[model samples]
Target: MCFRLSAEGTVLSVNRYGAEHLGYERNELVGQSLLRVVHEEDRPSVSRRLAECVVVPDTTTAWEFRKVRKDGSVLWVRERARAMTKPNGEAVLLVVCDDVTERKEVEQHLLEQRAQLRDLRLELSLAEQRERRRIGAGLHDSVGQDLAFARMKLRELEAETLASETRRCVEAIGQHLDEAIRATRTLTFELTSPILYELGLEAAIRNLVDRMGAQDTIRFTVRSSGSDETLPEDLNVILYRACAELLLNVRKHARCSEVEVAIECTEEGIRISVQDDGAGFDAGGAGKGSDRTGGYGLFSIREELQPLGGRFEVDSEPGRGTRAVIVAPRERTAIADAR
Candidate 1:
């Protein structure tokens, strides 16, 4: 849930989840000091963290802390807090947190037991690609070889036998086998794109943009700016998927013929935007299940965007096209450097 507080820690805004969890009505939470809800153990650390953020007001941090519920139950929470300023130049804070007590506990336990969670993450990535290659090898080595052998035997049968119907059936079976092998090859590449594993994010994206542009019905263009420096593979995947989602949303909800995808990188952060020339609608008209519909595609995009020092904004009108922009810290990539 989201909470926007004034400099004095008075709640100026409480999201629907915040209002329900704080055991306060919508109006009651406003103007209430959020410090009252801080669990005693975390009060010192939480306050310290906040101080560290405000002192510089440039660096951002994501943290996990405990907070006392009004019902007297303490929940382990993870906070995505950012330090900002109000119009009057007062320091204001906006926070989004989740009751991840159970999840945090699980992560903590795993951390303690596995001493190699970071290593495992690295291996998990490599292993995921290795497994894809293995599947590809299976298709090429076993299935592909079988198809070749079958075709050879069928050609021999065609030469030796005189039954026309039988020869045609044999050829068809051979064709099916060849088609199956081709499909398997395609599946392997899609599962773990070789370009990403072999080259890097920039080249892979360039290739992806080229492929997208080559499509017949819809036209696509991509603009890359900012730091094109190498980044963690996981960041590449997240950014790639986020862009892919936007384009897909365009294909589904937008009836436009062309779209533009742009990426900008700076010392502090990176921004990605996907804009379309299709019909748009009132974002406020979205309902709970709108996410399942085309309306909430941007919402899902935000879910992926926010975790890594990222944020997203959607702009659209009834007739004007939709533009989704994602902002993220350049250093805050999902995949850390290998130890």
Candidate 2:
């Protein structure tokens, strides 16, 4: 629809469609200030642009603003206007307008949907962490305690001067119970480490490496350097889990005897890298082929970090060692409350 406005922004004339769209007759709108329809918040900008158009006659300018109808409803409109002078030396504006309200609404809806999805993803990640903590607590407090009691009972029986064969059986039972208790404790730690919440990411990573190093199978070394500041609890959990998963992959698949984990804080963010002297697989085929480490562990780490605007990368080749890096931003909204 097209309309003509005086240099002063009064509506000189409007086409049939333009007048109808504003819920006014062409005659009813004549001589009315254009600001009558332009949304109040946009009037100042529209006024300034119109003034500019007058100063630079014949120059075309484009803008989008909300226009209110006679019925009091508002609609978004895109306007392209050019300034011109009449034979009588009076300046005027010729404007072409298109209603863009529907398009604007659709764009807003899509933005809202994306935001909702992000919130949902963060919430689910936090919920999973909370469940892990609960399961870990249960294992340590219930099953672990029961196994400890059983070991104590066996030791008590051993002190009762039982027969040699019976004593031998009791001792064996006590040993098995001890192993069970140890296994339960290990499983509990795997479910969730208290150090993660107690001390922070660095200490948690160190504890994890130390516990695994105790097995005497894989030689694990951890090096860290940074401001001793703690990270947000949620990010701390993510980094710790990523490191744990990468190290586990090394222990299980890497035939190499040595693994190194390094963490450092830089101006950009935190950098964590896990490298191992183990048989490495094709990095390109990771998460695609039948590689064990390329399965859920790596995929999950990538998925979890994405919402936080963090990044995960792996570099490896056949017969060479694999190095996995995770970089997390220093500032992010905390998902810890979701737990």
Candidate 3:
């Protein structure tokens, strides 16, 4: 459809097809205001764009807006318009419109599907966190407590008189029990650290780095800033997991001795960076099925963040080092309250 409107938005002329398309006769559309057929909700924006075209005269401005037909049905149209001088020494807008209702409908459908998928993923993450907390609590309250009680009873028995051989056997059993208790505690912390829920993301990360650094194979340093408020619980969990993943990849593949992790709050959101002075590989080729740095690979980590309004980036060069950064959006309007 085509239309020629005066600079003041009066419809000077409309093509035969354009008039009939709106259920109007050719003559009936002449001398009408162009805004008459525009959807009420879109009129303001259409008016603004028209003013812009008049200001920038020969430049084409394109946008999608809703137009109302003669029968009062709305139609989505992709419009392209340009203002130009007419032979009568007046300015007019030459407009071309294309039907885009089907495309618009498809786009809306895709957006709804994406929203549904994000909600489902959030539900699953929350469910998984609850399960982790339950198991961690059971390990601490049941098995851990039981083991401690047994150790205490063994100590009480040891205080009594016993033969040398018997005492030695009891001592060995106590040592084994100690090992078991330590292992259980480690597993519990890994499953769900109370520090993460009690403290914020920065504190939890510091604890993780300190614990890992104790191994002595790698030296880890953590620095953070701009973390004045606590993040949503579910968001913290995901951010924690992503940071842990990067650290694991460094431990397993970087083959370097020093690692640095930084957490900061930016205008966009929270940013976490993990850098290692280890064996770096070709990050460019890493996307082409190469993943020397394992643990959900770099590409997989990026793909996972895309749906959560987050970003994962990696910079690396062979024999230099690797730096991985993850940014998680600060908003939690769609997320439910933490359990």
Best by TM-score: 3
lDDT of 3: 0.85
What are the lDDT figures for the candidates, one per model? 0.70, 0.85, 0.85
TM-score of each: 0.51, 0.60, 0.73
Write the residue-wise lDDT of candidate 2 on 294-314 in tens digits: 554676777678777798899
lDDT of 1 by residue, 22-97 (tens): 6667687788777777898788888777666566554566898888777888788788777786677778777888
Cα error, residue 250 of model 2, in Å, equals 2.8
State each candidate's clash count. 0, 0, 0
lDDT of 2 at 170: 89
Candidate 3 ranges with C-alpha deviation above 4 Å: 4-13, 31-36, 39-63, 70-72, 80-96, 158-161, 226-230, 253-257, 265-271, 276-331, 337-339
Candidate 2: stretches off by over 4 Å: 1-119, 214-217, 227-229, 266-268, 285-292, 334-339
Flag the better candidate by TM-score, 1 or 2.
Answer: 2
Q: Residues 1-339, candidate 3: write the lDDT tens digits.
A: 999988888888899999988889978878988899999999999999998999888899999999999999989999999999877778889999999999999999999887676567556766887799889999999999999999999999899999999999999999999999999999998898778888878888889898888876899998888972657777788788778878888888899989999899865689899999988988887744359756457665665466567888889999999988898888865565322
C-alpha positional error of residue 75 in candidate 2 after TM-score superposition, expressed in Å = 16
Model 3 clash pairs? Answer: none
